[model samples]
Target: MAIDPKSFEAIADLAYRESGLQLVVEKASMIQSRLRHRLKAVGTDSFASYAELVCSDEGLDERRQMISALTTNVSHFFRESHHFELLGQKILPGLIDKLRAGRRFRVWSAGCSNGQEAYSIAMTMLETFPEMAKMDVKILATDIDPKVVSFGRSAVYPERLTTGIPKNLKDKYFSVQKGKEGDEYTASEALKSLVVFKELNLLSNWPMKQKMDVVFCRNVVIYFDADTQDRLWPRFHSLLNSDGHLFLGHSERISEPSNAGFINNGPTSYRPIVAKR
Candidate 1:
C-alpha cells in the first residue's frame, strides 16, 4: 500500500530532526520505498504504523534501522583518485617527516562506506612509507550505519567492486577468496591492521581525543543543510592539527573559507590556516 502523505511528511521530519539528513518532497517516494523493508521487519502493515513506532520511546533501535536503510553506501576503492594522489605525493612526505621525528600520524575516513576509502588510504600509506607499518600510524574509518561499520570491519568486497583498485595495489593488499556466489577479495592483514572501524553519527558527540592530520568527509555534508555544514566546518577545524587537510566532495564547498579558518589548497581540499606566534 502507498504511504499516506501525512505519514511521509512525519517520517521525513523525524529523519531530518534525528540525523540532520534533509529529505525533501521529491524524496518522499524514495523514502517510502526504502522504509518498506523496515515496515516488514517491524511487522507494520502501513507507513503510518511504522512512523508511529519510529517516533515512540520503544522504537529507538527501529529509528536507527530506518536511518541505516535511508543512508546511501555507494563507494569504491580509489573513488577520487586525485585525493589519493595528493596524499601520496604531497601529504605523506610531510607526515613521514613528523613520524621520523617521533610524532604519531592519523587520518580519518569519515562516512567511509564499506571500508574502501580507509583501505585505500592504508594501501597508499603502506606503499609510500613502508616504514609506517612499524610506526604509530592509524586510519580511523567511521560511518553512521552499524551494518556498514560491520562490513568495513570484515574488509571484504566482491571482485567487481575491486575494479577501481590498481593491479599493483590489488596484488599487494588483497587476497582472492573463492565463494559459492563468486570471487571475493579480502584486504590483507597488513592493510587491515592499520585501520579501525567504528560507527559514528556526525551529529553526535565525537569521542576521538587525538587530532587528525587528514579528514576525508567527501559527499557527506552535501546531505546536510547550509547551517549544519557551517557548524561542521569549525568542528572539523578543531579536530585537525596545524596545517591539517579537509577534503570534501566535488560538489561541496566550505562556504566562507576564511571564516572557517581554512584555505582552499586544491579542488575540494581545504587546509586550516596556521596560527601566528
Candidate 2:
C-alpha cells in the first residue's frame, strides 16, 4: 500500500530528528519503495502501522531500522579519483616524515558505506608508502547503519561492485573467491589490518579521542538540512589536526568555510585554519 500522507510525514519527521536525514515529499515514492522490505520485516503491510511502531518510545530498535531503510548507502571504490590523487601526491608526502618519526597517522572514512572508500585509502597508502605497514597508520571507517558497518567488516565485494578499483590495485590488494554471486574479491589481510570498521551516527557524540589527519565524509551531508550541516562543519574542524584535510562530496560545500575555521585548499577540500600568534 502507498504510504498515506500522514504516515509519510511522521516517518519523514522522525528520520530528520533521529538521523538528520532530510526527507522531501518528492522522494516519498522512493522512500516508500525502500521501506517496503522494512515493513515486511516488521510484519506490517501498512505504512501507518510501521510508522506508528517506529515512532514510539517502545520501538527504539525499529526506529534505527527505519532510519537505516531510509538512508542511501551507495558507494564505490575510489568513487572520486581526485581525492585519492590528492592524498597520494600531496597529503601523504607531508605526513610520511611524521609517521616515520613514530607519530600516529589516522584517517576517517565517515559515512563509509560498505567499506569501499576505506579500502581504497588503504590501497593508496600501501602503494604510496609501503613501510606504513610497520608504522602506526590506521583508517577508521564508520557508518550509521550497522548492516553496512558489518558489510564493511566482512571486507568482501562482489566482482561488479568493484569496477571502480583499478586492475593493478585489485590484483595486489584483493583475493579472488568463488561465491553465490559469481566471483567475489576479499580485501587482502594487509588492507584489512589498516582499517577498522565501526557503526556510528554522525549526529551522535563522536567517541574518537585522537584528531585525524584526513576525514572523508563525501556524499553524506547533502541529506542534512542547513542547520545540521552548519553544526557539523565546526565539529569536523575541531576533529582535524591543524594541518588536516576535510573532503566533502563534490555537490556539498560549507557556506562560509572560514566561518567554520576552514580554508579551502582544493576541490571540495578544506583545511583547519591555524590561529595567528
Candidate 3:
C-alpha cells in the first residue's frame, strides 16, 4: 500500500528528531519501502498504524529496529586509502612515541559500519608500529545501529568483501572460514582484540572518559542538517586531544574549520589546534 502524505511526514519528523537525519519528501518512497518489512513484522497492515506504534513510548525497541533498517551501512576495508596512508606515515610516528613514553593511545571510528574502518585502523597501527600490540592502544568503533555493532563485534565478512584489502595484510590478519553458503573471512584474534565495538547515538551524550588522538566520522554528517553539523564540529574539537586529527568524508567539510579550532591539513583532514596558555 502507498503511504499517505501525512504518514510520510510523521515518519520523517520522527526520524529527524531521533537521528538528526533529514528525510526530505523525495525520500518518502524510500522510507515507505524500508518500513514495509517492519510493518509486516509488527503485524500492522497500514503505515499509519506502524507510525503510531513507533511514536509511542512502548515502541522504543521498534524505533531502534526502524532506524537500523533505514541507516546506510556500505563500507569496506580501506575505503579511503589516503587517510590510512597518512595515519601510517605521518600520524602514527608521533603517537608511537607517546605510546612508548607511557601515554595511552586511542582512536575512534564513529559511524563505523560493520567494523571495517576500525579494523583498518588497527591493521595500519599494527603494521606500522608492531610494538603497539604490547602497549596500551585501543580503537573504539561505534554505530547507532545495534545490529551493525554486533556485526562489527563478530568481525566476519564474505570473501568477496575482502577484495580491496591489501593481500599481504589479508594473509596476516584474517583467517579463512569455510561456510556452507560461501567462504567467509574472519578477522584474526589479534586484530579483533585491538578494537571495541559499541552502539552510540551521535546526538546523545558520549560515554567516553578519555580523549581520542584520532576520530574518523566520515560520511555521517551529510545526513544531518547544517545546524546539527555546526553543533558537532565544536564537540569533536573538545573530544580530541591536543593536535589530534579529525577526518571526514570526501564531500563533508567543517563549515567553519578555523573557528572550530581545526587546522586544515589536507582534503577532509583537520588537526585541532591547542590554545596558547
Candidate 4:
C-alpha cells in the first residue's frame, strides 16, 4: 500500500507532538515507505487504516519497532572525535587533579546508544586513568531502549564496528571471533566490566544517588523540543556535581541562559556553577 503525502504529514505531526522528535518534513516519503512494509506484514493497503494501527492500535510490539527504524542511531567508536579528545586531554586530567587524593571518578553516559560510545569512554579512562582504576572510576551508561541496552551491555560487536579503533587499543580491549562472516569482534570482558548499563527514560523523574564528574549526553537532546530541552537541563544540573562538566553534541549546544547555573568552558563544553557553602 502506498502512503500518500497527506497521510504522511498527518502521522508525522502526531509522532512529533507525542515524542518531540522533530522529524523533518523531508522524511515524509521515508516514513510512508517504512510504514508500508509493516502494512505488508498486516496485509493492509489503505493509508487511513495503517495510520490507525500506528495511532491507537493493539500493536505496541510492532509500533516500538517502527519507532526504532524511524529514529536515527548513527554512532560509532570515537565519534565526533574532538569531544573524546577533550575528555582525554582536558576533562580527565583536570578531574584527576581535583580528586587525586580522593582517588575517585564517577562519570555518566546519558543516551548511550548501542554501547559503543559508553565503552569508548571506558576505554579512554582505562588508558588514561589506570593508576587510579583501583579506586572508583566507575561509568554509568544509560539509554531508554531496552533492546539496545541489552546489546550494549553484552559488549559484543561485529568487526566493522572496530573500523576507527586503534589496533593496539583493539587488541587490548576486544577479542576477535569467527562470526557469521568468519570474523567478528567483541569488547574484552576486562574493559566491558568497568561499565554499568541500565535502562533510563530521560523524560521522567530520575533516581541518581550521587552527582557525576562528567556527563556525556551527546546528540540526544536535539530530538527534543525547546520545552523538553528546558526541562532536561535542570535534571542534568542536579545530577552533576557542583563543579562537574557537561558534554553536548557538536551539532547541539546549550540553549538555556547562563543564569540557569551553567557556565561555558567553550562552545560544546559546559560546567556547573559551584555551589556556595
Candidate 5:
C-alpha cells in the first residue's frame, strides 16, 4: 500500500530528528518504494503502522533498521580522485614527520559506505610511504548503517566494484578469487589492518576521544538541512587537531568557513583555523 501523507510526514520527521535526512514531499514515492520491504519485515500492512512503531521509544532497533533502509550508500573506490591526490601530496608529508616524532596519525572516513574510502586512504599511504606500515597510524571508517559497517569490515568487493581502483594498486593491494558469478577481490591484510570500521550516526554523540588529523565526511551531509549542516561544521572543527583538514563532497560547501573555525584550504577542503598564541 502507498504511504499516506500523514505517515510520510511522520517518517520524514523521524528521519530528520534521528539522522538529519531531509525527506521532502517530492521524494515521497522514492521513500515509499524504498520502505515497502520494511513494512513486510516489520509485519505491518500499512505505512502508518510502520511509522508509529518506529517513532515510539520501544522501537529503537526498528528505527535504526528504518534509517539503514532509507540511507543512500552509493560509493566507489577513489570516487573523487582529487581528494586522494591532495592527501598524498599536501597532507601526508607533515603527518609523516609527526608520526616519526611519536604522534599517531589518524584519519576518519565518516560515512565510509562499504570501506572503499578508508581502504583507499590506507592503500595510498602504504604505497606512497611504505614505512607507514610500521608507523602508528589508523583510519576510522564509520557509517550510520550497521549493514554497511559489516560490509566494510569484510574488506571484500566484486569485480565490478573494483574498477575504480587503479590497476597497479589493485594488483598490489587486493587478492583476487574466482567466484561462481565472476571474480571477487579482498583487500590485503595490510590495508585492512590499518582500518577500523564502526557503525555511527552523525547526529549522535561521537565516542572517539582522540582528535583526527584528517576527516573525510564526503557526500554525507548533502541530505541534511542547512541548520543541521551548520550545526555539524563546528562539531567537525572541534574534533580536528591543529591544522587538521576536513574534506567534504564536491557538491557540498560550508558557505562560510571562518564561522566554523576553518579556512578554505583547497577544493572542498577546509582546515581548522588555529588561533595565534
Candidate 6:
C-alpha cells in the first residue's frame, strides 16, 4: 500500500529527533521513494509498521539498514577543490619547512561517506610530498553509516564519481573499468592504500587516540542542531593539535561563542588561537 504523506513525514521527524538528522519537509518525497524499496525487500507495506520496526530495540539492525537506504550519500572526487589547493599551497609547504624533524602528519576526514574526499587529500599529498614519502601521513576517514564506509573502503566508483575529479588526476591515479555498471574510474590501489575508513558517529565518542593536524568535515554538520553543533565544535577543537586546522562545509561556517577564539583563516577554513600562536 502507498503510504500517506502525514505518516511519512512523522517518521522522518522521528529520525530527526532521535538521530539528529534534519531532512527538510520537501525531502519527504525522497524518503518515501528510498525507504519504499526497503519496504518491498522486507515484504512490509505500511509506513507505521515500518516505523515501529525501526523504533524497536530488537530491530536495531533493521533500523540501521533503513537509514542506509533513506539517507543520500552523493559524494565525488575533489569536493570543494579549493580546500585541497589551499592545503598544497598554504599548509603543506609551511609544515614541511617548519616541522619537528621526521614528524608525522595526521588528518581526519569526518563524514567521509565513500572515501572520495579522503583519497583526494591523500592523492594531493602524494603528488606534493614525494620527498616526504618516508614520513608518516595517515588519513582517518570516518562516517556514520557502516554500509557506505565499507563501500567506500572498496575504492570503486562509477564515472559519475569522477565528475569533479580533474582530468590529469584521472589519467594518473584511477584505472577505467568498462564492464562495471557503477563509477567508471575506480580508485587505484595506490591511492586506496593511503586512506583508512571506519564507521563513526560524530555525535558519539570519537575513539581517536591521537590529535590531528588537518580535519576535513565538509557537508556534514548541517544535519546537527545548534546545541549539537555547539557541543561538537569544542570537541573538534580539543582533538586538534595546537597548530591544527579545521575545515567546515562550504555552506557550513562556524561563528563566535560556538567557535570563539578561532582565527578567520579563510572563507571555509578556521584555526584555533592556539594554532595561530
lDDT of 5: 0.92
Candidate 5 local lDDT, residue 44 = 83
Tens-digit per-residue lDDT, 99-191, candidate 6: 437777899999998888998898888788765545777889998788889988888777866677778888888998785575477777767
With a 3 Å backbone cut-off (N, CA, C), the pairs that clash in candidate 6 are 157-183, 158-182, 158-183, 158-184, 159-183, 159-184
Model 5 stretches astray by more than 4 angstroms? none
Predicted structure with the largest lDDT when compared to the true one: 2
Q: What is the lDDT of residue 131 in candidate 2?
A: 98
* Total backbone clashes of candidate 3, pairs 3 or more residues apart or in separate chains: 0
Please give the range of 10 consecutive residues that has the lowest summed lDDT in model 3: 94-103
- Which parts of model 1 are misplaced by more than 4 Å? none
Instruction: Report the Cα lDDT for residue 157, model 5.
Output: 93
- Model 6 clash count equals 6
Question: What is the total number of backbone clashes in candidate 1?
Answer: 0
- Candidate 4's C-alpha runs over 4 A off are 5-10, 41-43, 97-104, 131-133, 275-277
lDDT to native, each model: 0.90, 0.93, 0.91, 0.76, 0.92, 0.79
Report the lDDT tens digits of candidate 1 across residue range 1-277.
7888888888888888887899887777787788899999989798888989999999999999999999998889888789999999999897677798888889999999888999999998988888988899999999999999999999888887787998888887889989767999999999999999999999889999989999999999999999999999999999999878999988999989989899998999999999899
Candidate 4 worst ten-residue window by lDDT: 61-70
Query: What TM-score, over all chains together, does every model reach?
Result: 0.98, 0.98, 0.98, 0.86, 0.98, 0.90
The predictions' CA RMSDs to the true structure, in order, are 1.0, 0.8, 1.0, 2.7, 1.0, 2.5
User: What does candidate 4's lDDT look like per residue over 1-277, in tens digits?
Assistant: 5667666766777566544567666766777766677777767888777667767767565555556556566678888777678788887887776557775678888889888888888888878777655666788888766777898888878877666788898898888888887677888766776789987767655677888888999898888878878877777888888778888898877776475679888768888888678
Query: Model 2: per-residue lDDT, tens digit, 1-277?
Result: 7999999999989898889999999988999899999899989899999989988888899898887888799989998899999999999998788889999999999999999999999998999999999999999999999999999999989998897998998989999999997999999999999999999999999999999999999999999999999999999999999989999999999999999999999899999999999
Indicate the worst ten consecutive residues by lDDT in candidate 1. Answer: 24-33
